[model samples]
Structures are given as C-alpha cells and as structure tokens.
Target: MLAIDGSFLDFKQLDLLALRQTPVHRLDPRAKVLTTLCFIICVVSFDRYQISAMLPFLIYPAVLMAVGDLPFGYIMRKIVIVIPFALMIGLFNPIFDRQVLMQIGSLDIWGGWISCISILIRAILTASAAIILVAITGFPAICEALEKLKMPQTFAVQLLFLYRYIFVLTDEGVRTARARQLRTFGKRGLGIRHFGSLVGHLLLRTWERAERIHMAMLARGFAGEIHSTRRQSHFGRTELLFMGGWISLFILLRLYNAPQLLGGLFTGTMP
Candidate 1:
C-alpha cells in the first residue's frame, strides 16, 4: 500500500517541481521541447560502439537540472527505475556477438560489450533529458507546445488525458488493494487466486469514477480543449537563442568526438 501511494506521489512531484520560478521554468515550453527533442535525436544517433562521444550529452540534462532547480537525487531515482528495461533489451548481446573490437593490454574487449554499454548510456542520457523536461516544463505545457507545433489536437488531447488519468487509475488500484487487505485476515484472501477479482473490482470502480469525472468536466465547460490559468508567453528572442545554441552544440557533438580529439591532442597524437 505504501509503495503504491509513494509511487503516485513521486509521479506527481514532477508537477510540483515545474511550479518553481526558475529561468528554465520560465522559458517558452516550445523552446525546451524542441531542444530536448534535438538532444534525444543526437544521443540516439551514435553508432552502437560509440560511448565516449555520448558522454558530453550528459551536460545538457545536468545543466538543465541545476538551472531549473530540480532535485538530482529524485530525478536519478526515477531514471534508475526504468533502467532495467534497457538492461534486459541488451542483455544477450554478449552471447551472440563474440567478435573482439578492441584490445586493452592482455584482455580483449568484444563488440557486444561495447554495444551493451552504449545502449545503457543512451538510455540513461535520453531518460534524464526527458525527466528533466517534464520536471521543468510540466505535462500540460508540453501538450500545449505540441499542439502549437502541428501535432493533431485529438492526439494531444488523448495524450494529456492519459497522463492525467494515470494518477486516478493508480489511486483506484491502491484503494482496491487496501480494501482487499482489510477484509481478509492473515493473508487468507491475499493469495494469487484473488488477484483477478481484485483487478475486476478496480476496473469497475475506475470506470465509474472516470464517468463522474467526465460529467464534472462537462459541467464545467470542458470542450475537448485544456486551458491554463498561466499566461501564455510568446516565442521571443530568448527562446530562439536557447533553442539555437543547444541545437548548434548538438550538431557539433554529433559530428565530432570531442573527447577522442582532446585525448589525441593531449598525447601528441593529433593527425
């Protein structure tokens, strides 16, 4: 019960972080969204064996978190939770690709190992960028930005609804689980046999609750469009500079391995 409730709180905390009055938070959402999109594209564009070249991308998220005043530990924990999926996706690379890619002294490093590490690094960088985007911009503003960026209204509305109702669904699940625990004694009805019934109850309860919410929204003049109380800011010079500068840097990093070049220069091996 506590785990479920805690997870819900953690999920909602991003909105709370977005409420802070930081420079990053004050920028137009479209600028941040575009910059983050470019960052993800650059991070994923690296070759499978390319690792060091991607390390510099970490600077984007780190700088954003600092300027946005987001809590590093909280964001790191959220990133860590989804890492296992990336790990599982690349776990078998070593078994199938045994060809050696590099030699370090006596030990041989295989292509699979390098690719696996590359996948993990890409996952971390992309996940951190996305989490920081939400922590600073909030989901509503992101959806609004997407709508302005030519994303279909229906798609944007559905996406926003999905994000919003996730909390409701999680809350419903928690209540159902608690009710099950209370009615049973000493794990009598807590077995896997009752799992299906508990899920069924949760679904019914959630459906009814969703109907109520929809009715309330309709009564309050919700006409398939989300409105915000915050004043909408124009995409001004600051936004242009913010997006342009980061995009230029992303292109530079994508084209050249700065780390490798610096290492060569330092070792008098520049060619």
Candidate 2:
C-alpha cells in the first residue's frame, strides 16, 4: 500500500489526538475554545517590543500540551511551518529601527532586533496554543462550542465547511498529481503546455466530487447546520474553574513584567 502523504498524516494525527480520552480532550469544548481565545489575546496584546512580557504566556500552551498528552516535536514542527510567514512580515524591523536598547559586555541589542524577535515569540506562542486547542477539542467540537456560545450561525457554518473541505481539496490535488505522474512515466509531468487544461480538469473534478458529497448529505437528511451525536456539554463547575484559573493567570502575566520580576527575585538583578 502507498504510504499516506505526510501532510495528511499530520492532519489525521491531530484529529486522532482529539479522540483520545485525556482530561484535556474531555473538557467542555466551549471552555477550551474560550480559554484558547483568551490565551491568544493575552499573547498578541503585548507591545511589539515586549519580548519579556511574552515569556510567561508560554506556560498556558505548555500546560495544555502536557495535560493533553500532545507530542512536543509534532506540534513544534507544525509551529515551525508558520515561523517563516511571521519572519517574512517582520524581517525589516532591524533595518528600519536600529536604536540600541541594551548592552551585554561587547554586544549591543538593537530595539528592532528585540521587536522582531518579539513578533516571532508571540507568533509561536499563539500558534502553538491554537494547535493544542484543536488537538484537544477537534474541529467539529469547536464549531459546536462556538454555536453554543452564540457565534453567528452563518460564520460558524462557513467555518465548519471550510475546515472539512480542506481534506477534500488535498485529496483531489494529490490524486490528480499522482495520475499525472503515472501517465508521464516519471520523466516529466504536467508540462506548462498542459498546465491550463490540467488546472481546469482539477477544478472540475473537485467540484463534481463536492456535488456528489452534497447529494449524499441530502440523501442522509443533512440540515443547513452540521449536527453532532456527542451530547451537549455545559460550562459547569469544572469548566468555570478552568476558565477562571487561566484567565486570572493570563491577566497577571499581561499586567506584570514577569520575566524581570522573576529574574530579579532569583538573581538579584532587575531590568
């Protein structure tokens, strides 16, 4: 049998992790979703140069990963894929803002470098939190949780379909590419002369596949909204405690220069 594609394998791994019986996976999805939203907010709210303030926010994702039994390397690799996008957007900071912010021995730390690193740190923290949330709560449960929290129905429905269509799209792309490869006998595949026709055929094929899926859903009485067989979960005491604890921690981290404070306490040096 052909080995599954690596990208699809990672996707399946996350979905499978959500199906595990860990406590984090079993939390009311609404709670997990809201907490993750808060975590992202706290991390993103830091100043463009406030790298020190961002360090404490790492605790939230770390806890979730540990509690959810998530693989550190797998999640970090997913996070690595996002770093270049952040760098692409923020890389000019050092060139534009070159004021020295600090000195260590013979080295000078530029404010722009600090700010650029800050952006990268914040990106990793926020992205990892999101990945951990999906790993624990899964996509469908998150949609249901959002609906329960009164997210606009249209937006929620669109989100659900968008997430589901990704797999469909990837599958179609891989199969199309594989067929092209087979026909070309590994010498050349889908040359520029044939690119336009292949592009059209790929779209047409994916559309037909989606149409058949829609018809199948209709035959099975799929309503305008996606429904789940999972029982409705409530934000009870456990969820309330979970949300409260994290929010409090996030608030504290947001309001304090945690790194300086802790570093001073430990080493008698203050920034």
Candidate 3:
C-alpha cells in the first residue's frame, strides 16, 4: 500500500536523524526518556483551563530540538495533524458548560472555550516533546533505555520485534501489490471479489515471513531478549548532572508559574 510506503519512509527519516553526533544525541537515552516522561506528566497535570502556564514548558522541546538538530518544520507538521484529536478532548466544554466566564470586548467568553484552548496547548506541548525525543533517540535506543530503567522484559521485546519486522512485512506487502498490479494488466482487477483471497494470501505470506524471522533469530541465539549493543548502561557524572538539572527544572516549573513571572517582568508585578 502507498500508505505503507509513506509510513516506512517517515520512520526511516527519523532513524537517520537519530544517527547524528550532536551533544543531545550523545547523551544517555535514559536522560532524554526520563526527562521527556517527566515533561509529559507535568504538562498533562495542569488543569484544563491552564494554557499560559503551559507555555514555559515549551523550553524543554525547543532546547532539545536545537541541541539535537531536529527539524522544527517536521515536528510542527506532526503536531498540526494531531491537533484536532487533542482539541476534541475538550472541544465540547463550551456546549455543555456554557456559563459565561467573562466578557471579552463585546463577546461573552465561555469557560468551555477557555478549557478547550488549554487542552490544545497542553497537547501541543506534550506532542512536541514526544516527537523531539523519538527523533533524537530513535525507537531502538529508547527501548534499550526502557529496559535499563527496569521496564518489563516482555514489553521491551515486543517493541523491538515489531520494529524489526515491520519493514519485512511492508516489503512483502509491496511486492504482493506490485505482482497483482502487473497481473492486472491495466484492468480493474483488485475488486471486492478478489479482496478476500488477496488478504488471505498476504496473511499466509506474513506468517511464513514471520516464521523465517523467528528461525533466524533462534539461530542467532536471540534467547527471548532483545540485546542492544549501542548503548552501555552506565551512570556517569555528565548523565547525573543532565538528569538532576532537568528534573530540578521540571520540579521548579511545577511549583512556580514561569509564564506569569515572565509576563510580569517589566510591570513590577513579578513574584
């Protein structure tokens, strides 16, 4: 499927991006994963009506994007597609809770609209942080980082295998499509009648391909665990500093309102 190709290409691009030797990329994947998890939790913990407070949270992703050399345009585009889903989480607040909060100029501002905007802001902040993390760390390293963090072995192995075989599955599907296309000979072949048989064949092929992969892994002594040779599990001074600094910042941001403080800087109203 064309969609399959597109999905594979997007992942390939992110994987290539992760191979760069930037400082952010060189840091322990645990640092990034832990920081990102904390960031997401903090951002989501904000109330449904706290938008401006979430602004300062953008610093995490912005700095990571710069340090990791990730493409801002790519991240923004992804957030755009995901925005509608996030918006829906609070989009109906205005209709159900129409009690007017205040009057903005000639318009009555509803609490629902404010809450909706807040959810969207939180969504953007959290989504951008995740995208930046994956672009910098790649899925493989993240899995390794999770394993090191004592995540369940079964979950990590499942993730690694899915990533490993998705390519093979896609390739086989593409070949199947090409063969069908060639046999069709400029005719309308893949009609509803052929759909069942076509899907069944693809399923059979996928099973066979999966069995082959299982055998290969067994031959290579997979031993039911996905081993990553790329990252050594170690806690050095730099990693400690990196973790402590960002975590402290997250705690501080959670305790204080950075956005309001910045906003009141020139008005002599800062606390």
Candidate 4:
C-alpha cells in the first residue's frame, strides 16, 4: 500500500472572538457561521437592479438580532459606520447609467440609481450579517466552528493568537499614548521630534512585550500548538429549525418575486 503524506498543509490563524458564548453565542457556532456565509451568497447573487426583491431578506438580520438578543442600537451603529464605504463606491453608478428605468410623477429614476441601491443594500446585508455574527458569536467560536467544519488547525491557532494579542497591544498603545501626552505639554502632538520618539518607543515596547509573552507561554508548556480541548458547539433541533427557516425563506425569495407591500412594488414585480 502507498503511504499518504500529511505535510503539505500550511499553518493558519484562528479568530478569537469567534469562539465566544451568549444566547446567540451558544447556539451552534457552525450554524451561525454558515448562516452568515449563506446570507452573503444570497445577497450577492441578486441582480444589480434587484431592490424590491431583496427587502424580504432584511427579516433574516432582524430575526437574528432579535432572537439572538443582540444589541439593536449597537448593530445599527456598526451598520452606519460601514455604509459610507458602500455609498462612496456605489455613487458613481448613477453618473454613468442615466438610462431612465422608471418614471414616478415629475421625477424620472435611472437604472443606475436602482443598481446603486441594490449594491448598497447588498453591502449593508453582507456587512451587517458579518457584524452581527461577530457581535453575537464572537471570533474564537467562529474559528472553532471553522475548525470543526474541517478547517486547518494551524490557521485556527493563528487567528486565536492574533486576536488574543491585539487587545494586549491595544492596552500597550493606551499606555504609550498616556506617556506621550505627559511629555507633550507644550509641543504640538505630531511634531517631528515627538513623532519620531513616539514611533520608536512604541515599536520597541511592543516587540519587548511580545517576546516576553512568548517566553511566558513557552514556560507554561505551550508547545508548537495553541491547544484547547473544549467541547465544540452542538447542533440540535432548534439550530436546525433556525437554519432551515431562513434557508427556506431565502430560497422562496430567490424563486418567486416578493409581495408588493414588502417593497416589491418599488421594482414593479410581485410574482
């Protein structure tokens, strides 16, 4: 018999917050994780002018945030922050299209505007789902879910370490900022002398701390792997039901046109 080699795979990182736990947190990270993937796939599959058909899709995020008991205002705030990026990219569509797709009273709307709306909606749906997924499930759980779904362990470990140290480094940054403030009583904050020393010192301190942390981990028996044998999240009937309901809704929206009152009227189709 020929022997198979397992040495070709490379190491990968884990996302720390993906492994967190809450009400929405504990319900099968795999399901929550996969649902987000499905959401993206569905949103991106829509035609550029597929606006009204996509409105029903909002129910997915709404139900998720509500049932998952996520922070409503916080999720909305995150959406706001990311919207500008989509708008900046999508705004150009109107200037090019100028083709009047529809007429409403005195104003005529171009297909470009409609397409822009579709792109923006797709962006919001994709970004919001991602944010909510992270907000509810956290990063570590996501990595764990990925691993459980057959992702490489090395990558998962990297994601874990990256997230673990990001906060640590951020705290270090705060301290460094405080020290800089103490020295900048009269000088401009970003003057040449102050800026050079600040950059130099922060880099030195970060490297020193990283080395120390690595040593500490090695001392505590952190071998080549960042191993944790925690129980993986289980998928039960509830999770199956949750995933199925949304999936069915997605398929239904994909196959037939959405109802008029649900925003389909805006697109002039209600099949």
Q: Which candidate wins on TM-score?
A: 1
Q: Per-residue CA lDDT of candidate 4, range 18-87, in tens?
A: 3444566678878888878887788799888888878878988898778666667766766876789999
10 residues in a row with least lDDT, candidate 3? 226-235
| RMSD in angstroms between candidate 1 and the native structure over all alpha carbons | 2.3
Steric collisions counted per model: 0, 0, 0, 22
Task: Return whichever of 1 and 2 wins on lDDT.
Answer: 1
Candidate 3: lDDT over CA atoms? 0.83
lDDT of 3 at 187: 86
Higher-ranked by TM-score: 2 or 3: 2
lDDT on C-alpha atoms for all candidate structures:
0.90, 0.86, 0.83, 0.75
Model 3, residue 8: C-alpha shift (Å): 3.6
**Predicted structure 1, TM vs. truth:** 0.90
Tell me the TM-score of model 3: 0.83
Cα displacement (angstroms), candidate 4, residue 226, comes to 1.9
Select the stronger candidate by TM-score from 1 and 3: 1
lDDT of 3 by residue, 1-271 (tens): 6766776667677788888988888888898899889888888898776777777788888898998888888778767767999877877888887878879799998889988888888888888888788888888889888988999978988898788778877787788788888899978796877868878998998788778888998999988776667556466788788878988898888878887887788687877
Residue pairs with backbone atoms closer than 3 Å in model 3 (clashes): none
Worst ten-residue run, lDDT, model 1? 224-233
Ranking by TM-score: 1, 2, 3, 4
The order by descending lDDT is 1, 2, 3, 4
Candidate 1 vs candidate 4: which has greater TM-score? 1
- Deviating ranges (above 4 Å) for candidate 2: 1-4, 181-197, 222-227, 266-271
Write candidate 1's Cα lDDT for 1-271 as tens digits.
8976897789988899999999999999999999999999999988999999999888899999999988989999999977999999889998888999999999999898889999999999999999999999999899889988999888888888899889878887888787888888657785887998888888888789879988999999999876666457789999999999999999999999989998999998974
